[model samples]
Target: MTAPQCPVAHEVFDQQYMRDPYGTYASLHEKGPVHRIMTPEGFPAWLVTGFEETRDALADRRLVRSIEYAGEDYRTLPLPAEFSTKTVATEDGAEHMRLRKFMNKSFAIKRVRALRKRVVELTDGYIDAMGESGETDLMTAIALPLPITITGDIMGVPDEDRANFQYWTDSMLGINTEVVREAGATMLGFLKRLIDDKRTNPGDDIFSDWIAWTDDDGKHLDDHELIGLGFMVLLGGYDTTVGMIGGGMLALLNDRPKLERLRANPEQIPDAVEELLRLYGTAHTGVRRFATEDMTIGGVDIKKGDVVLCSMGAADRDPARFENPDEVDLDRPNLTHIAFGQGPHYCPGSELGRMEIAIAIETLLRRLPNLELAAPADSVQWREAYLIRAPKAIPIRY
Candidate 1:
């Protein structure tokens, strides 16, 4: 005998859904851990709602990420051009190991820790610029610029070209097909030129490292791979960090008591960052995985070729793994939240991202102790997209 189907008719992509996904996810968990539902793009897929199931799915070799291994039926699902970019995100097994190995040194703990002083200096500059404004769009003045600047430096983006890089990156996140195409093309062209420039004048940056990296097998990234990896790294390092900074700040500001608690003892900033990430992760969805064979997750039958969208946000808030999952608890002992995701493809820049966010919060509290949201919490508009769950702007006053 087989388990009966339990298809859910929930809308996974609505703006309202993005606003209160934890609530919706809780309801979905009532139906079951795995729900067959429509994606924001209006395609059907399986969403894993359970904590353990999502963790397992992320590391499951049976759930292949490359569309090359996708079942014929699942192949019809529309994929962003980024999918075909052949970056680390798209590969698995040996090829993934090769790419991960080559990129490891650049993100190693020592390298990321060495960036702390730079991050502090950058944060102070941004705060100084915000000095007399009295009120400012935190997103524009601080959250967005800090990480973008750092990633720009790391990728060797010319200071003069950063404005264009910002435009292309923002456009790449657009839902409009024409805009995405134009932005993608412009970014690719920019990256090609950047890579070419690095060939003759290699600098002490990740781009130069990728150009010069080698392993025992003599493996290295070619120009094409470099372009993909470069764009992916930039997007990963900037967008997600911005989201965490902005979102985490809101989480702190909204709860004055908690804010004051952390303010009183800054030693807990790291743990507070972990709790903030767990409560409201930057991404609601995880990397898409296609089932290579029939499987049952949390007692739901998933067929071969079916696309599984693991909801990391949903998993993080699962009651089974978290107590008072929706509330931000700085003392939450278990920081096993998969905000940066889990398994082999775990975000390469997570440590750096955490440092950026923690420093951003600490700097704000110290510099502007009276900082408060300039608008009502409910009025802050969130991005109406599935890819990133972040506010459009976080207006603030000190």
Candidate 2:
């Protein structure tokens, strides 16, 4: 089938859109669920906006995550070879399931639930360091370090090595291409060494488990696959959780009534966490997928090999699927937002992320009864990245 005539491409991920994307998403939804759009990097892709369409596109087997299916014109984030091989995010079908199976146990509900006391301990320690805070950047003081430390803890990275890992991870994800390349190489080398050590000296951590694990058929991930999985875990576990905690906290601090309600009824924090995720959830865009065959999503025709971006941020706030989609209603019955995405590639660490966020928020509300934004809400700066959504910093007073 031939490609359909495209509409004028809207530059939807520009600086202005980064500041606030929901308005643009609402505008796109009003016209249609899918639209031709230009990414910040100047590549054209189809953007799925409506909640139903976004969810359907995520689950559609016709759309695949492997770059091999992408047309020559499709552009993807640049990654070192070590970072690209055998990752669950880049695989499909049986291979994806196999790769994911190795990680499922570590992030299982029981395992995540077991992590609650440790999460609380870490959170309390961070809050205690704030020392009855007068003012501080929450991102630095808690949001950034908490998740990174937890990731290091779970991966069995030595305490002395965490700072280096954190530096490399931040540089690799930053806007500087040169820094990204250099940091990717450094991080790869570090991961290789870490894996080598884990093989010889296993410990009670995920990395050690992965090193020792083999399926019923006596198969296991090779060094390259282990390296890639290690990189993916570091990125996925650290950045997104940081965003969720920081963004969710910022959202709650701005709404005193909701904050107080959560503080008063700590039990409601779990449900309230769902509402925060719906309103301020990160993972602004889903993994980029290439259409494997001609298909239609939300009445918009997609050509084979075309790039498609499903906007979780847009989908979660879609009015057709959610009443008062923009507002935070803790009582909202339909909490089925695709914040963690859907289908085969759904986030494996979702339970861990949810527990981290819930514990972080609950502890903050309980301890810092007067927590509020130190600076004007509108003055807060947002980090401008194509795939993630989070503030640069959240200044707070308690």
Best-fitting candidate, measured by lDDT?
A: 2
Output the lDDT of residue 108, model 1.
94
Per-prediction tally of clashes: 0, 0
Per-residue alpha-carbon lDDT of model 1 for 310-378, expressed as tens digits?
889888889888888888877777578889888888899999999999999999988888799999887
lDDT agreement of model 2 with the native: 0.84
TM-score of each: 0.94, 0.95
Candidate 1 Cα outliers beyond 4 Å, as residue runs: 1-10, 75-83
lDDT of each: 0.81, 0.84
RMSD of each: 2.1, 2.2
Native-to-model Cα distance after best TM-score fit, residue 75 in candidate 1, in Å: 5.8
Residue 91 CA displacement from its true place in model 1, Å: 0.4
Cα deviation of 85, candidate 2, in Å: 3.2
Candidate 2 local lDDT, residue 218: 86
